[model samples]
Target: MGIYSISDLAELTGVKTHTLRVWEKRYGLLTPQRTDTNIRYYLDSDLKGTHAGVKTLQQRGTNFQDSRNDCGRDGGGM
Candidate 1:
């Protein structure tokens, strides 16, 4: 149950922090936990899930925004 910060996720997943924030707000694809200090944190499961979702959508010929929206609608990957 490793908890990762946005920067950690960005480094591990190769997704920009800004883009990830957009996905969270716009698509609601990921729901990260918040610390008492108002810092965002993601669990390992969340990271893996998001990674799979992004890859699946990319393979389906969807751009980032479209993929994010589609994941929201499709429950984030197949």
Candidate 2:
């Protein structure tokens, strides 16, 4: 079980820390645990899902229509 801070996840995934926070809040992508000090941290599975989700969201780019077009062309390429 890996533990990662927001900075770590951002560094690892190249998804800006602010963007990660937005995905967490706006899309419920990554569910981080908070320390008593309120610092957010993530588990391995959380990071894994967030990593995958970021890839998908980057490709989708806030538009399901574009995503569907890609899917139609590529059979839901991942």
Best by lDDT: 1
Backbone clash count for every predicted candidate, in the order shown = 0, 0
What alpha-carbon RMSD in Å does predicted model 1 have with respect to the real structure? 5.2
Show the lowest summed lDDT stretch of 10 residues, model 1.
69-78
TM-score of each: 0.74, 0.69
lDDT of 1: 0.77
Candidate 1 local lDDT, 1-78, one digit each (tens): 899999999888877888778768866768999999989999998799778966876788876666547556432222
Question: What are the per-residue Cα lDDT tens digits for candidate 2 across 13-46?
Answer: 7767876776677557678999999999988897
List CA RMSD, all candidates. 5.2, 7.5
Runs off by more than 4 Å, candidate 1:
65-78
**CA lDDT of each prediction against the hidden true structure:** 0.77, 0.71
